[model samples]
Target: MSRVLLLGGTGDALRIARSLRAEHVYSLAGLGRTPVDLACGVRVGGFGGAQGLVRYLADEAIALLVDATHPYAARISANARAASSDARVPYWALRRPAWEPQADDDWRFVDAWPHVVAALAPFRRPLFTLGREPLAHLDAIPAHQHWTVRCLDAHPGNERARIIDARGPFTLDGERALFDAGGYDVVVSKNSGGAATEAKLQVARERRLPVVMLRRPALPAADREFGDVAGVIDALRAQPFPIVR
Candidate 1:
């Protein structure tokens, strides 16, 4: 039987990992929590780069490489595509669709950090949901601005910023309360399309606050692409190898 290798970090990836058998492997970048309850074997940390990944695929006999990482994780996706090609293995990706602006949403799309900073100049209080990226800029916060940054891990923020460590699948009411308390004039977020953290967008729309959205990067094409976990699971089940959970 052919063995599968799943690269994952996002919630969608975890869902896919849960459906895998013990013969399959679930790989993580070691940034967040590692699950001990998974039936499939778990491997943490990186494979150096594309060349290293090619070696790993060959050494481990990975027949299928599934990239279920976050949508913004462009480098890893690119490496997976390259490594799969080099190793002559099938590559699959779960490319989550980005969130679209609704009728009442005031969204400003930015391609880089400098652009995001420029767009945020006028706002006194801004809520940031771009993960750990905002933590590095805490010292650079403008004199008149106070930032509320949310990410996966807790950190000690400077006087101009406050860090809240939390995960999502957040509720609408919870987001409404947070927005009300923060009194945020603007929201800084990545266009990571999923139900997990999408409540913030709806709250922003309801409160008439503008959102500065980080643009999605161009990822390398995979042999097959899926938009959701169910589709990926179905595809895996259809593979020649037995993938029963």
Candidate 2:
């Protein structure tokens, strides 16, 4: 049976990883908690780049490469496609659908950081769900603004900003409490289409707050693309290797 290499970090990726056989490998970028309960082999950290990943695939005899990374992870996805092509392996991607704006949503889409900053100028209290990107701009925060940033890990934030370290699969009540406590006038987010962190959007909608959305990046094409974990699982089952249930 051929071995599979799954590049993953998202919750959706974890679900697919859980279904892989022991011979298959799950790779992470070493950003958050590494799961110890997985049946397949877990490889943490990067593979250098596309060339390095190609070496890894050849060294480990990886026959299938699956890109299950976050939607914002364009570079990694690109590398995965390039590496898979060079290694002569099939490349599959799980492209989760982006969130659609509801009729009540006040979503302002921005392609870059400067635009996000411009969109945020009118709001005094902004809740940033764009991860650690805001942490870098803490010192640049306007005197009138107080930034609240949420990411996977905790960090020491300056007086102008407050960093909250938390993982998602967040509930509506929890999001409501967060919004209430923060008293945020605006929300800064990526169009990461998944249920895990979607409650914030609902909370924003309820409060009638404007969300400064970072536009999704264009990703490389794959031999097969799946919209959800179940689709990927089904595809894997049809592959030559037997999936570990």
Candidate 2 lDDT by residue in tens digits, 118-212:
99989999999997788888889999999999999989998888999999989999999999899999999999998999999999999899999
Tell me, what's the RMSD of every candidate? 0.7, 0.9
* Worst 10-residue lDDT window, candidate 2: 236-245
For candidate 1, the lDDT comes to: 0.94
Model 2 vs truth, CA RMSD: 0.9
Per-residue lDDT for 19-98 in model 1, tens only? 99998999999999999999999999999999999999999888999999998999999999999999999999999999
> What TM-score against the true fold does each predicted structure earn?
0.99, 0.98
Instruction: Report how far off residue 124 is in candidate 1 (Å).
Output: 0.5
Evaluate model 2: give its lDDT. Answer: 0.94
